[model samples]
Target chain A: MSSIHEITLMLNGDPVEAAVAAHTLLVDFLRDSHALRGVKRSCDMQVCGACTVLVDGRPVSSCTMLAVDADGASVVTIEGLGGPDGLDPVQEAFLEHGALQCGFCTPGFILATKALLATNPSPSREEIVHHLSGNICRCTGYQKIIEAVESLAR
Target chain B: MLPRPFTYHRPTSLDEAVTLMARHVDDVSPYAGGTELLLAMKMHFADYEHLVDLKRISELRAVKRNGGTLSIGALATHAAIAADAAIQGSLPALAGLCGSIANARVRAAGTIGGNLCFAEPRADPPVLLAALDAQLCLISARGERHVAASQFITGALETVRAPDEILLRIDIPLTARSTRYERVVHGHRTVAGAAAVIAQDAHAAPRVWLGCVATHPVALPNAEAHVAANPGVLDNALTQAIASDIARLDIADDEDASADYRRHLATTVAIRAITATVEQEERA
Candidate 1:
């Protein structure tokens, strides 16, 4: 039988609580329950990084993670990155470099970049490529994305 | 797609986790990073009525060096293993391999225990761990037992671990003076992988294992014998030895690669791995 878990976690710096079913995936929880549609669901198999999210400062495949697993952890969705004032630096970099043609993959790429920059503030070109390898983007051929992230590298 | 509904048990201790597993035996699975298990469940390939989440068991995440052995807790994530100072100091090659497994997200979420337990034919850790002569400690309500990494995996997605048992940790002795792991990746998955190790005592026979080219990691006895016979050689004879050994394995054509192509790739990696170890030995 399915069980309901009452989970309390920090979402995008805000404390939130919910009752999630055992089988509810984190991607569905964010998009459906919280209406955070910025986290897209393309490849539910974890191969595609379209459903990427930061759990405790590390990038994880939200499509494969259960919502209940996020209890007591801090999760950051794409919606959590920017504010009403302005876009996140990673998003701004993408905009300036024309890194996106279709924006379906932008959020995942940006968040993955954010996670990379968190641990390695100045990742080399190879490091950036390696870190974002999981996040696939069919549009723009990834040149602009690499350039955008490279510009941010110190 | 969402997995079929099941009861989730979050056990804070290893004993609690095993107790839950024993109680639910045939219907339960001990959940780790869920990188493989959840994906399989979503695809409707495998389903369990109960899942005992082992994340909260802190003891299962430790990575420490105890004298001559490196003890890696079962729940240690690939990222954790890669960044660990103990593993880096004792077996930097393993740390490097862990860093490159799958991708960044997978590295952050997938654990070595989960990888071994799932026993995916294309997985990376098994071949390298087997070559290192690592030991796995499994615990159950009845008792605990130790098994060699080389014999832990029986086949693809198959292991000797009983349903009521939980893999506690992996203990690797720091006896190898030089080690190298080489693989050919078609995409994110490895098409073929080879690991070679030369023990600190020069007289000991070299260990060589091939993975991702078969159902489980297979010891390349002929390749090991070649390395043993020719201590510091990377010649055509060595290549022939690896090729001949690979030819004997029963490989099948799959969508990723053909049998002949896999054999070729396996030989290339095996030779490269042995050559790398030899080069490292010379440098030392």
Candidate 2:
């Protein structure tokens, strides 16, 4: 019985393997081991959505979750979204709407919006607000972000 | 902040999880979702040398209805419970409440068992579960026993669950009762909350419970007695009954809300819950 757990999972689109300590957080593992700096770490508590990432297609606060928890799951971060040629549609929508200011909270907002749209292709304005309420954005005053996400709604 | 190093064990079965808990005693915690436990661990508020990961146990994730009971697996996440078809069809009020808890990320990762077991004073589920007369099933190396939801939480961040016990599931008996849960929330924390469960028959006893205003959820026996006697009446007498019951609760003034304000909100939410329950009954 060892505290060091060998975990293998799909990171973004690639299959990756790592032997992480039992106490290692998923956010630390993502940003430190894989260098996915896009996954911001503001407010280690789950209250702030800065550390949100998708595990098995559902958004979870990576900061509160253990790296080993993502072992058999497919995890998607902001770095996993766009293609080499162009940005993802969500990114394009955010860019078009000018949904960012300092852009520190942009990655988290974009990823949360992607998750929202993936499950519900057509979401009401209220639904979008309710879904993204966990992800805080102090820069854009949230109006532009809502409008940006609204533009992508079906 | 990082939690101290610990041994993580992912047990595939209930017996194995029980054995692990029994082996480690106070040094272990059954990790489910980890939305609350991990945060506490990182903050150095709690420490455990061993964590028995309960995610792999398939039996603990089942949400099903058998005969007259709705058995909700303890490990069922808030998001999963909100989206569960059976919950939506049978207990839509509970489903709606689950959807509104915390935010998208917390809902996705927070488990009902973890929420109830954590026994956070501001949590939402315990009140509703108690009002609905839910039975909590706990298993250990010794055997299985059921505790009424109302008696589960002893104090804030405390429960009667032993070190070797694991919460298996929540059993809610399906009855002809219309339930409504109402709350006032400041940010993610519930300020004051109430649950009203009114039976279809006017003669049957109605259940009302208030939470987030005290150390633990408590039954408003006086108010419930009034409701049970009057049946759908929300007059001055009912209001007085509610006020008397609220006066008995040991509420504290906190940064989230003042003691006076919480009492006001508690009374308001309780009236709203009962009114909504009555309205629901009328519609049905």
RMSD of each: 1.0, 1.3
Chain A TM-score vs. truth, each candidate: 0.97, 0.96
TM-score of every candidate: 0.98, 0.98
Model 2 stretches astray by more than 4 angstroms: none
Give every collision pair in model 1.
none
Which runs in model 1 stand beyond 4 Å of their true positions? Answer: none
Q: What is the DockQ of each candidate?
A: 0.88, 0.73
Q: List model 2 lDDT by residue over A1-154, tens digit each.
A: 3399999999998999999999999999999999999899998898878888889988988999999999989999999988988999999998998889998888888889988998999999999999999988877459999999999988
Q: With candidate 1 superimposed using the best TM-score fit, by how many Å does residue B104's alpha carbon deviate from the native? A: 0.8
Judged by TM-score, which candidate is best? Answer: 1
**Error at B94, model 2, angstroms:** 0.6
- Worst ten-residue run, lDDT, model 1 chain B? B238-247
- For A41-104, candidate 1 gives per-residue lDDT tens digits of 9978778799999999999989999999999999998889889999999999999999998899
